[model samples]
Target: MVGLEMNELKKIGLGLTGFGVFFLFFGVIFFFDKGLLAVGNILFVSGVMTTIGVQSSLQFFTKRGNFKGTVSFGIGFFLVIIGWPVIGMAAEAYGFIILCSGFWSTISVFMQKIPVIGWLFQRFGLNQP
Candidate 1:
């Protein structure tokens, strides 16, 4: 029962994360709309926390190696909330790249499992690992 609930929660978290990305994409498409970007940031952070659980999320974000990324991300989020979408997004992108660096390999592996995209990735030799 507990395992089932966890799986369900993860599914919901994934949904929220997907929506967050969707909003972020649209925000950029619409010339960095501040409201959309702010909502996206909120949803993304909440989704990540929900997906990983509060304690694990805290540990991951607060790790010594992640301190810089964490601070940058937080500042960027604040900037977005204050109506500086472009600059905030730039900072957030940098922070996101740094924070997700460790997960790139895993992400690449997952991407390589997709259908047409996976074929293209393989053909292009983008899946280094």
Candidate 2:
């Protein structure tokens, strides 16, 4: 019933997310080509965010998972590396956003919970709220 529907939605989200990642990978493989790499990377990230956002929202409605925004908040880090010489500053800007907001913060949160991780966070002052 409701569970089945939720599962289906989750599947759809995961599928889209996979495609988005594949698109990014494709961009990486063809790094020499500026046009394809830039366009493809942007599209892939956008698609992933959209699908995940939808899934997260649905889960939130059902009181299952909290709705984190679709934007991977920190993907810009990898994007910056991809962008630099290839796509230029614009892409790098996006990369920074992804890095500072999405990935780094999330990992930092998890790190604060583990003993060793917490120590590391304290050492680096990365656990500040």
Candidate 3:
């Protein structure tokens, strides 16, 4: 069980690291191409910070719970949304996740269930029975 968990962690770590490095490199390229520095920098930093957050999520939140991870992920996601267009594909990808999370988190509070929206919330496990 321990070995299995370690393997899963290693896989997750590699995935997050790869994702972060991809954005970092892309941001650097954008900078060289005279693209928006603010967007590039935001993407670069958010990628790095998000990756670190995910990699350390387990150990960092083992005792504290996943609230911190959720917040960091949320912030990273918000940056991605704001950085898109001026930033590139990396931002869009992360932004989509943030948008989805936002919908999930907020949809449950809605008194009236809108078609499809409520279904999405439940499907994503944000709306409890």
TM-score list, all predictions? 0.87, 0.39, 0.28
Rank by lDDT, descending?
Answer: 1, 2, 3
Shift of residue 21 alpha carbon in model 2, Å: 1.9
Can you tell me which runs of candidate 3 are displaced by over 4 Å?
1-9, 32-77, 84-129
RMSD of each: 2.3, 8.3, 14.4
Clashes of 1: 0
Candidate 2, residues 103-128, lDDT tens digits: the string is 67777778788998799889998877
- lDDT per residue for candidate 3 within 10-90, as digits (tens), equals 655556556555655665576523234334445544444454555454554342444444455445445545554334444
Highest TM-score scorer? 1
Q: Rate the local accuracy (lDDT) of all candidates.
A: 0.89, 0.53, 0.50
Full candidate order by TM-score, most accurate first = 1, 2, 3
2 or 3, which is superior by TM-score? 2
User: Residue 47 error for model 3, in Å?
Assistant: 11
- Deviation from native of the Cα of residue 65 in model 2, angstroms: 24
- Candidate 2 overall Cα lDDT vs. reference? 0.53
Candidate 2 Cα errors over 4 Å, as ranges: 1-6, 32-85, 92-107, 111-125
